[model samples]
Target: MTVDRRPGGVLELRGVAGGYGGATVVRDLDLTVGSGEALAVLGASGSGKTTVLRMIAGLHPVSAGRILVDGRRVDPLPAQHRGIGLVPQQGALFPHLSVAKNVGFGLVPVDPLARWRSRRERAARVREVLDLVGLADRADDRPSRLSGGQQQRVALARALAPGSGLILLDEPFSALDAALRGRVRAEVSALLAESGATSVLVTHDRA
Candidate 1:
């Protein structure tokens, strides 16, 4: 339940079992992701790939076994407290907020006494992540203004904005066209590699 944070990378699931009430989707599954590694969990529609991702993201309770982050157990932690970034199939962006604000949403408040003081710092972080995802110019743009691929990039930037060491991507590129999917996947893969983030990517298409 208690996981120790390592310098980076390393996500392990041991004998993980879980499902919706009596129905089990994932059973006795074990997996590991090294630092800066990209792992693809390829499966059919009902293969429980997303379920495994949710379990690692702490969205689903593990009925048995342990979930470890960098060699530390995290079974008892909440989703946000687990330091896992999950990018669902849907872009899941806020319609009213600009790209920058949405990406910076994960930033922790500076202080209980003076929250306004961290605005500049937060903005800087947002810009850094936006640029990393090649959307710096769209900081002020709304999600409605961006294309599907662009919106996914914004989502990726938002997930990375928090500096989480591990990321769980569940068919994040499923909405993109074939051409655009290749481009966006390459960009995201490169960015994650450069940032030294260990990621588990779930996809139905083997390609």
Candidate 2:
């Protein structure tokens, strides 16, 4: 795999704090993840790992501090505009759409060139991403027909399709079987490194 020479877009959280109203989960958190690096946030149940991702993804408002992507403040922008790729713990794939459509959903608007604006282009891009996740042949299948691990890969493919500078994964490998988990993890790690993706993973898994 060839690595991108340019910066992967740095992710920095300074003095960050936020949660549901009248509640505080992450407090005064300060972190810096350089281009192409993965930062894992690990904690037990109710320990606020998900909350941190939610806040960063703009799903949950930030009550304090700042989130920066490549030195630009991102809290004011919506999730899609912030150039973020997110894989929630639930592997939130659109049940109605085929795996190919789901993975290609983000690319249509994200790419501006007229040549890339075609549906065929999006489908090709979808195939490329699925191949990376080891689901190239499952493109026509629906999410319901896939195994848990396969579904997770579909969700992951959706996230990766946009080629977002920042990737936020919430227990991304949770649904995978043990043998598949290790292989998937290594593949994902290599993919991110090759593509120069800056990633943050939130997990409660102690192992």
Best by TM-score: 1
TM-score of each: 0.90, 0.87
- Worst 10 contiguous positions by lDDT, candidate 1: 1-10
Residue-level lDDT of model 1, residues 1-207, one tens digit each, is 111222446989999999896998898888888887889999999888988998888888899899999888998888867777878898899999999989988787534542223778777778878887778899999999999888988888877776788888999998888989988888888877766778899999888
lDDT of 2 by residue, 143-205 (tens): 999977778778877877776778899998887778888876776677677656788998876
Evaluate model 1: give its lDDT: 0.83
How far out, in Å, is residue 170 in model 2?
0.5
Model 1, residue 138: what's the lDDT? 92
> In model 2, which runs have C-alpha deviations exceeding 4 angstroms?
1-7, 110-116, 177-180
lDDT of 1 at 52: 91
